[model samples]
Target: MPEISRFLGMIIAMYYDDHAPPHFHVRYGDREAVIRINDLACIQGNLPPKAMGLVIEWAMAHKEELEKDWALARQDLPLNKIAPLE
Candidate 1:
C-alpha cells in the first residue's frame, strides 16, 4: 500500500491494481478501514468514532484527489500526495 496522506495519526493509502469499486485504505493505530471513494462509505474494517469522523471529513474534502489517485493506482503509476486534514 502507498500512503497518500497522513493527519492526526491517521494514515491514508491505496494499493496498486487493487480490487473494484475504487477505495482507499485508512490506518489509525491498529484499526483500519477501506473507504469507498464514491460515497465515502466504509466498505471494510473498522475505526474508532472520532477517527472515523475525521477520515470521512478528510475524504470528503479530497474525494476528487482520491479518485484521481485511484486511477493512477490502477495503472500502477505513482500516486499524488493529498493534503492532510488540518
Candidate 2:
C-alpha cells in the first residue's frame, strides 16, 4: 500500500494493482474503510460518524486527485501525495 495523504489522524492510501471501481483505503485508529473514488461510497469496512464525515469531506475535495492516484496505482507507478484536509 502507498500512502497518499493523512490528516486529522486519518491515513489515506491505495494499493498497487488493487480491485476495480477505483477506490482508496482509509485508516483511522482501528477503524478502516474502502472509499470509492467515483461516488465517495464506502465499499467495505467502517468508520466513526465524525471520522467518516471528515473522510467524505476530504474525498470530495480531492476526488480528481484520487482518480489520478488510482490510475497510477493500477499501473504500479509512483502515486502523488495529495494535500490533506486542513
Candidate 3:
C-alpha cells in the first residue's frame, strides 16, 4: 500500500495488488474503509459517518488524479502522484 496522504492522523492509501474498478483505503484510528474511486462507494468494511464525509470530500477533490491513478493501476504501472483532497 502506498500512503497517498494523511490528515488529522487519518491515512489514505492505495494497494497496487488490490483489484476491481480501483479504490483506496482510509484508516482513521481503529476505523477503516475501502472506497471505490469512480462512485465513491464503500465496497467493504466500515467508516464513521463524519470520517466518511471527510474522505468523500477528499475523493471528490482529487477525482481526476484518482482516475488517472486507477488507469495506471490497471496497467500495473507505478503511481507517480496521487493527490489527496486538500
Candidate 4:
C-alpha cells in the first residue's frame, strides 16, 4: 500500500491492483477503514467517530484526486500525494 495523504493523525493509503469499487484505506491509530471513492462511504473496517468525520471531510474535498489515484493504482503507477486538511 502507498500513502496518499496524512493529517490529524489519520493516514490514507491505497494498494496497487486492489479490488473493485475503487476504495482507499484509512488508518487512525489501531483503527482502519476502506472508503469508496465515488460515495466516500466506509466499505470495510472502522474508525473513531472524530477520525471518521475528518476522513469524510477530507475525502469530499479531494474526491477527484482520489479517483485519479485509484486509476493510477489499478495500473500500479506511482500515486500523487493529496494535500491534507488544514
Q: Rank the candidates by lDDT, best first.
A: 1, 2, 4, 3
Per-candidate Cα lDDT values, in order, are 0.95, 0.94, 0.82, 0.93
* lDDT, residue 85, model 3: 53
Clashing pairs in 2: none
Stretches of model 3 off by over 4 angstroms after superposition = none
For residues 1-86, what per-residue lDDT tens digits would candidate 4 score against the true structure?
89999998899999997889999999998998999989888999999898899899999999999999999988888999999997
1-86 in candidate 1: lDDT tens per residue?
A: 89999999999999997899999999999998999999999999999999999999999999999999999998889999999998
Best by lDDT: 1
For candidate 2, what is the TM-score? 0.97
Q: Estimate each model's TM-score.
A: 0.97, 0.97, 0.85, 0.97
Residue-pair clashes per candidate: 0, 0, 0, 0
Give Cα distance to truth, residue 35, candidate 1, Å.
0.3
RMSD (CA, angstroms), candidate 2: 0.6
